[model samples]
Target: MEANSNIPSSHTLWSPHDTVKDAAESLGIALPDEAAKNLAMDVEYRIHEILETAVKFMRHSKRRLLMTSDINHALEMLNIEPLYGYDNTQQLNFKETLVGAGGQTLYYIDDKEMDLEKLINQPLPTVPRQTTFTAHWLAVEGVQPMIPQNPLPSEIKSIPPFARGATSSTLGNDITSSGLSSDVTMKDRDDQSRNKNTGLSQNASEVKPLVKHVLSKELKLYFDKVVEVLITTDPEKENLKYAALTSLKNDPGLHQLVPYFIQFVAEQITNQLRNIEILTTMLEVISALADNKTLFLDPYVHTLMPCILTLLLAKRIGPASKDNNSSEAEDSLKKQLAVREFAAILLDHIIKVYGSSYSTLKARVTRTLLRALLDYSKPVGTHYGTLLGLKNMGPEVIKLVVIGNLKIWYKQVIEDSNKTDYEINILLNTILDIFRHIKVEVDNAENTSDGAQSISEDVKLKLEERVGTKLAELILEQPDAIAIVRGIFFGEINI
Candidate 1:
């Protein structure tokens, strides 16, 4: 019998007996025959357990092939220290050698040591570049875009068909079934046979429908023409301008053009700060778009709010014409005030219509207007715009923001020693208008009450002090100031 006849053929052929004998010889000790067999069996069982655990790591990493790191991780999980100096990226080469006169072959992996000096003297590798990312649409509206990132249609069609039916039919069969062509039936059958031979279905392969986005040429031309007429500087095109505005207001299929119009308006407002005509036209466009019941403006309210506020609070608008009389300047100021008032009305409409949808919309608008009002660097016109903007926000905002800040603002900014009496009176009258509105509400609240409208004298004195001496003096001058001030401070009446 052969020397290896005692070993079972079905069991693993690799034996750890040689490794155990070699280790004992290196230590100047002899491993007995029976002791070597028992140690070899123990080592084989431990290796088998490790390999089984390594397979689990392979599946967890979504890989079919086992790796050195997997074995190391398995060893760590089993509470055993893993072997070092094994590079997972390098392949291991095993050498077969004949041992002694018995002609038994031994397979051992070769692990050569590296020279420390040579390794340290080698040139360093170049540093790698930093990674970056970019974004593009892989699919749109349920169809994959034909970009480099997605596989081609031909590649997808190359996949072999199975027992399941195809998702769609071919063009030839579609034509033949529809009775559009009579002679193509034989050719279609021949193609079907060929497809079946190639493991494709006889039922035609499915092609995903391509959805194309297309804007009409006429609409594009109309959009361009309308914009041209609206922004024209020629005095003769005033009628054309009105026609353009009218078309925008009533046009049915202008949903796509709405963004373009908004962008155009924003650009024009920024570029044409000195052109009142352009500014006016932009405002009109906004109004017309807002009034169109068919168009949805909710998504764009934040974008539009800034432009409207700019019109209301800009320090100077329109060109200063040369050699202007006082009357001309006054008329020009009136025109600006009119624009601000119109913008304020539009803002009021925006808040009323869309405020409930956006939780912070009202607060954001109120803060912006208040900031503009408190900015002392701004001219009286800006201050007036801020005042009008606050008033249009309704009684609650006026009571919360405008009423509390009025006395300090009037004393510091409105009563500037350099300002003319006319300007000061204009500012004071605007302040007084707020008080007047509050007074009307107070009167109504008092008349509707079941009991007499009354406040303790001490509480009344404290409320007067909070109103500040300047505003208190102004309030006392009014006919029903006491009732109004009490109602306002106590929140019994809305402003």
Candidate 2:
């Protein structure tokens, strides 16, 4: 058979004649035309066959590039001796040298020679320790023991807030018991059976709801002690109250008591409406809880909001004016204003932090404040709280709600003769403060010095028309009155 005729054209485009002739020359063998042709085709066929099998190995290994080891595996499968000195990871570098005259070139492997003497004198490598794992129960009879041998569950993955509707001590899913019913538990079932035997199931129709979390006795004691310290008439316990607030703000692992704190606040505020000190203390608790980084308070923010809004927008936070003497009433009024101020701050913080959790939370809170602020009958204290809330909502709320409706509220609530001069002055100062705390840097910030020092009588009437006469007169007192006035009507910096 003719080897050249049998060789596929696809396998040998350049032909292997030159390679075979060089090999025969090195061996000092005689070469003939027919023998060289046949040998050349045969070598090409064999080389192609080896690469085809290597390609299959590359594909089987799910690799795009074929490695040297794949060729060796293919050679072994074909019963051929693979060429030595080939490593899968090592690169084969070929150094080119200029050869005989005419600028000819020769390329060969750039192998680095090793020193056998130096290698033999080197220190022997240390033996690796044997691989070992100790046997330990991860969980015994459904309860995970807190041991160093077992990894803690928290390190593996984070438990999302409110993701677990219910949990069990024995809720093992590793080829063990099924889940417990939401409405009942194992202990409840046992108690029901005992009750039935004693003819008591007739009275107890259903089991009470399962506790969402098990509160430790230590936490309950701490909570009760904190509440007692905060509400005690004894001024000596002020240190203890400060310590409790500090712990509530900085301590970790207090997630279990978040709901209880919110509840304690709600109940205290309701029962102690007439008591300013208690109401202020409760607001402090809410603020401390919000500041705690470890507590997942997002789930309980909705429940805590009512207490904040109540304190913020309530008509009267302290004793009725008619029931108390003038001095006592004045002091109580200051306390009321303080409670409302703190409540407003807390509400603004909650909306900013958890606003993304509920898309409409900010909007709803803004609407509530607006309603209280716009109502002429809602007392001056309510307007003060709402203004503070709107101010804290950011520049936009201040610009749109507070500044836009300042005329109506200032004229109706601020100028009301029914309210005391002290209350009116306090509210007026708050209006000025809304402008003071408002930090809007206009493009005309540089031009404030260049602009007119005072508002002319013409723009003054427009300013008074914009915000009530009282606010207009006060705004004119500032050096940047022209810029503030421009920012208000022309959207420059008034808010």
**TM-score per model over all chains:** 0.58, 0.54
Best by lDDT: 2
Candidate 1 C-alpha RMSD relative to the actual structure: 21.5
Clashing pairs in 2: 487-492, 487-493
> What TM-score would you give candidate 1 relative to the actual structure?
0.58
How many residue pairs in model 1 have overlapping backbones?
0
**C-alpha lDDT of candidate 1 relative to the true structure:** 0.72
Model 2, global lDDT: 0.73
The lowest-lDDT stretch of 10 consecutive residues in candidate 2 is 171-180
Please give the CA lDDT of all the candidate structures.
0.72, 0.73
204-261 per-residue lDDT for model 2 (tens digits): 4434345355578998898788778878878888888899899999999777677778
**Number of the top TM-score candidate:** 1
